[model samples]
Target: MYFVDTLETEGLGNRSYLAGGPGGAVAVDPPRDIDRVIAAAARRGVPIAYVAETHVHNDYVTGGLELARLTGAHYLVPADAAVSYRRVLVHDGDEFDVDPVNGLGLHAVATPGHTPHHTSYVLTERGRPLAAFTGGSLLIGTVGRPDLVEPRLTEELARAQHRSARRLVEQLPDETAVLPTHGFGSFCSVGRVGTDATTTIGAERHRNDALVKDVDRFVADLLAALSDIPAYYAHMGPVNSAGPRPLDLTPPEPADAEELARRLAAGEWVVDLRARTAFAAGHLAGSFNFEGKGRLATYLAWLIPWGKPVTLLAASPEQVAAAQRELARVGIDRPAAAATGRPEDWLRPGDHLRAFPRATFADLAAVWRTGARPVVLDVRRSAERAAGRIEGSLHVPVHQLHGRTAELPEGSEVWVHCATGMRAAIAASLLDAAGHRVVAVDDDFAVAAAAGLPVDTSDEAG
Candidate 1:
């Protein structure tokens, strides 16, 4: 009956849980930070029994395998699941009995549809269900979406998801405590679930809009709200399926401003790990402004180049230390140093370094209509463009921009746009340094569409 919930928050929030008996515990859907889970297990004076995943996750990087390797725990997934990892797969009706040792038992209920082989765990204290950990299969207020696949498989998957939700509703008791793997803000849960981390099945059954007993409508509602899933989702799925790589928890130290400047010249990204407000107020020219103060490590791993040397511009010494810890969570080991003083002091006159002009979607559209005729560089990924893109824009993803410099005319003025401002800013700076006049259009397409600019759509989109 011992249960622990770990919440990971940045732009995307993920929750992982450790639940089990006395001698050994089981980790369910552990996040990329395995140290916290390991530390918690050490505090409880128990060895990990197994690291279990409810389904193949498409959001945050899964840390289950790392936990398994670090603690010598078995890695478990649903039986017959087509994943990349070597695991002890459990099937429906499979019982993980810990009763003989610690008075707890776990039963695996095959609940497909979120993926091909999703499972829900029913924990029992004395042959009675106490809690159910429904991974992505069911959230607090919504059921798993059935249409994550291609159009050919969307309906099939949706139907399977519908049946899965109905099966869980039919089998599980109303009063059973329910803990889902994701919450609000998760790309996986999207708009279906609310923000709360945990709730009872009884509460969900009564309050959940998607679980209203009209299965077809439930499936339709879930599918209709599906937007373009983040590339990180599919990117992390294979990582989870195979097993999480161990992250180095010790982040490197910061170099002085001069040294950081040298590193930046050497093609390193000096990420300012401050807040956007801090970045907007004043920051080192050319510093990428993700400033993920809290989940600094997560975004560092996600957006910035992995294992690349980083120069951190933290607000304080404590913030620097916190940044180091966060980076270590995801194995980003090389952080060069904090700037000598405030980030502003480093911005001296005559430094060709310039922050790109940031514009909202509406503003950019207006600029596009002007006679200036700036070259619009769509810095979003090709997959994102498949959904919809601004017309007459050249495709140059941020990752490939540095490599494809030859494609750009050296003196041409470039206007960059991504789904958001973050990538666009980064791309604009790269273009600027490479001798192109660049500006950043920092708005979502909705804003662009509202401005009545032309939008091109394609079938390959999300």
Candidate 2:
């Protein structure tokens, strides 16, 4: 009677899980914020007996150690993990039996490749396998990118990932649940092409690129699919090894318009969490917009320099508090300051709320329908661009745009767009800052396709 509950970290595209039966339960790969996990346990009326780590996370800090400490649950970590703190060191095939009522147990399966110390945990009820917490080893539509560990180890790890995926499916039942930590929307996927967010061992055996390809092809494709690791990723491993500070969800200090401007003058990031429409119509001149409704945590965490002081620009205290919650999941525990209200109210004598025009896909398509020329800037990732893009859009990934501004054409209105408008707003600001007349395509990517705009695939795009 084992059942699994999912906890999605939306911005990171990661999933943690809780498994329980009548006897008790365990949490796997909980996020830095432990309150929710505590609440989940309380709701289920089960004491969490263990908090397990599939690996030392490199994208966000984990709450495993702290959760276990707070709840008095056993902390299970890989035997070779670099943690200086204490944990129940587990090895291949190690088994743990839960309380008598649960009729459930856990079996460790060594499945390295995402990292050297990665391990998967299998849930079994009365010796029958039910599910495997594959973590970053084998993901939904892809396997975890092996290159995040170290430069020299990339190919070796990819090969190991091949072997690991093979062993997992071979040993586990086809119907066994395949739960993973990466590849949902996170940048940690390697050669991910499908849309399924969760899959069974049988499904992976049938279609997963990692399981279906030969070792050489798999390794080649995996290496080819590596994306630029977020600049902030370097700090994650060491922090996890030493131990992350227990999360603090305190709201940031309120900043007046003048103080916020001063902070911006001093080079602090003033991120606007409002929607693209609101941000474009009015925002602090130098502020970056990730749009709090979108993947605020991932993009903001990716773009902002590590340990940089950040002050949020929002329309209300509630928005500021909401943004804080998302940022904290990635271990950005404290925002230096936050200010609410329209930017114009805080505008200094010489300063003004920057306003940029936004266009829908239809507007751009109409331009093409007419004889008018427009410079479309596609700031999506290579994979996303390949999925579909405007035939002639300038293909600079948003992260790479700041440096490649020179390559863009000069005359026509530079229109920026990503899969959704969120990335586009960020790029529009960069282009504007770089002295280009820009229009943010503040609408869904489907709009462009639906409007019968000129679109191309990866081959045609390049």
Candidate 3:
């Protein structure tokens, strides 16, 4: 009997797989933190025989190289990917015995759409296909985005993605498990992805865009729906291709109150990783809040100036460590400093804690009843804004907010909101740190219309 265990990095919206029978296991698209993969193998009571990469990932650093080195496993990477390190260059239709005793093996199928070198791996037991690890090519409901590699090759890649998805459906059994690495919530996905935990080739055949639409339609729709990618993604592909450095999860140096203040004053990122509510209630002045419970890596790495020294202030050491791990996955390997305790603990002597109000759309409506005209800043993506948005609101996606803060109207209290409140809180913190009075709309965007706000449901939203 064989087993497949999933290792999900929810912050980055990707999944890695560990699958094997009695002989050994193979880890597919592992993250930078190899300890979890190691622990999973330990629990399975199997030495990992191989670490496979579907392609050079553009979302997070791959742990494949280190995981393979540590386990003495064959590191499988696409043959065409230009990498500095040594690896088993996997080619189309290449087969490797994962468990010769049980007749378990992996078959590489070149599925070049997510990247020119992207490949999908099929896990077979006794020459019968059991699962297909379709890295960025064949996802649950949508295919991986093709524009990540190079803008000039986007349309060509999109056409390639269609062919690749069809190839998987044609070559694999209908029941072959479609295990993908990018669609869970990763920006690597292009269209509306399914929320189901598991899906098979048969299920995806009826619904997946690549399978449902012809190549021309699929490519057109994919290019149309493509949204802004995380700024940090620009670094991930090169890091993976060149071979990611070993991950370091060591707690950063302790930052005294004065040092924290000095760093903040120097315009360094002093991130407060507390619950959004706690952060809104009180935080050290000039400290930005990226809730420890939220997508810290995705947002922080997307917004912060690349290579800026970061200092973390959290309510506890565990929170700091957790944030550090999340950041490390996206290549923010080392935090300059960290502090734990209440906001007051990180405040310098004679300095007071800063606060911003968190209100719902109802409160926003109530404020408008009194004729208050605060600048409502919609920080959702442009695609989301185009679907529906509060009329007259200024739009700036959260990732672009740091550099575009000047575009927001000055001398007005900015009321910031996103699909949910987490991003709004991040934006609120940014506005607060920039010396603007802000209110975080801690409510779902779904409630905005019912709250009597003027919502414009059209292609154009100001």
Please give the CA lDDT of all the candidate structures: 0.68, 0.85, 0.92
Which lDDT tens digits does candidate 2 get at residues 14-78? 88998978778889999888898999888888889988999999888888888998999999999
Q: What's the distance in Å from true for residue 66, model 2? A: 1.2
Model 3 agreement with the true structure over 350-390: per-residue lDDT tens digits: 98998989999999988887887779999999988888998
Clashes of 1: 6
lDDT of 2 at 201: 94
What TM-score does prediction 2 earn?
0.92
Q: Per-candidate TM vs. native? A: 0.72, 0.92, 0.99
Residue-wise C-alpha lDDT for candidate 1, range 1-462, written one tens digit per residue: 555555454445556777776766778887776777888777777778878888877666667777787788878788766677678888998887643465677788888777778898887776788788888777777766655545677667766766766677788788888877766555566345766656877787776755664767766676666755543354566666665666654535657656767877888878776655455455566576655544344344555554567777766767666666555534454466665457655654555335445677777668767854667788776657888877777887766676686797677777778886767766665665566776667677666777867787867432
Quote the lDDT for 223 in model 3: 98
Looking at model 3, residue 304 earns an lDDT score of 91
Cα-based lDDT at residue 65, candidate 2: 83
